[model samples]
Target: MTQEKFEHIYQRAEERKGGETQLENLIYQPLSNDDLRCITDDRWLAGFTEKVFQCGISWNVVRKKWPNFEEVFFGFKIDSLMMLSDEMWEKKAQDPRIIRHLTKVMTIPANAMMIRSARQQHDSFSEMVAEWPSESITELWDYLKKHGKRLGGNTGAYALRQMGKDTFILSSDVESYLRQTGIIDSGRTTKRAQLAANKAFNQWQQESGRSLSEISQIIAYSCGDNRVL
Candidate 1:
């Protein structure tokens, strides 16, 4: 099915958000490839872990304790984390400086390894992320879901977005918009649904000359009960 032009969507978003300036202010632009390349693997692991911990929990709670998390996780240094034993990870889980969720705590080591593996194959984990083609972003998402622990569905997408990857998140509003538009007729996380969303976003990107990040936010702002001031 043919989707509505991105111009119409952007106009509705501008109207909902009070005007063009307000909507533009609300949209965050993704970093360029060079900027993305400079981000270290440790920071990438940290970003991923933050989103993993924030999943299904109050982001405020995670935000407040984030420094302590950095401290307890040894700044998320990939090599140091890789050297840690299971016993060390267990101690980390029990540490009062951060949340005591063992499952989430364990993602640190697993994701660290994922980054390390990427580093071995490419110049660095950041380079791999930077060089990944936007045309097949879902494939990168699939790689993370396959190779990293607890990074399936929106978790990996959120992490990638946080680390400046130009990928659209399948947020609730975006998913609803897709479903309403007949963009996908299956489960939101299914491969078919992701590819469909990707194609629509590509079309919108071509039409608007906006990054996926901006388009995703615009699509979100166009629908839903987002408050305007």
Candidate 2:
């Protein structure tokens, strides 16, 4: 596949934005404990939980209420959140300050425990992330899908890319661009489709030398979104 087709679309996006664009500007900055003055567990928790809550909901709502979410989850400190009793989460489901999807709310603790477990073995969750294989990033996605709550499919991938992990997110637009460009079959988010997409990206990275983050953003930009919905 020609990278130029994707680049042409992104170039149009650049021109629409008054003739200048930066790939990093269009993507979320990756986070680290040292960079944000936060612990690795907390950092992972934040990205994980945010992706969970944003699923099937307007992302704008999640963005607006995230501060309250941070406060309620004790800045997403793993031990602090683990101490929250079931009754506490029940109360949070009724809290007005945040979206109260009970299942999603409960995932915070499950996810916290996941990071804590990783910390136990790796010294810090960020270290685990750092050591994760970038060349086979889909393996990281598979691990999250198996081990973490609400982390299946795009949610896990979304969290990784949002935290600046060297990964790709198969968001709707990204998938569409892939299909239209003759990279993968169209219809349903299936295992075969995921594997094919991963293979295509692996080849593209080899050919173009772009990070999966930038490549994924380029795919999204190829669909011509100049602004948020």
Q: Report model 1's TM-score to 2 decimal places.
A: 0.97
Write model 2 residue lDDT over 54-147, tens digit each, in one string. 9999999999999999987789888777877899889987888999889999888888877778766886777777777667777778778877
Q: Write the per-residue lDDT of candidate 1 for residues 1-229, one digit (tens) a residue.
A: 6799999999899999999999999989899999999998889999999999999999999999999999988899987888888998999899998989999999899888888888678999889999998878999999999999999999999999988899999999999999999998899889999999999999998988889989999999999887586
Query: lDDT at 92 for candidate 1?
Result: 87
Give the Cα-based TM-score of candidate 2 against the true structure.
0.81
RMSD of each: 1.0, 3.6
Which ten contiguous residues of candidate 2 have the minimum total lDDT? 30-39
Which candidate's lDDT is highest?
1
lDDT (C-alpha, whole model) for all candidates: 0.92, 0.75
Write down the lDDT that model 1 would get. Answer: 0.92
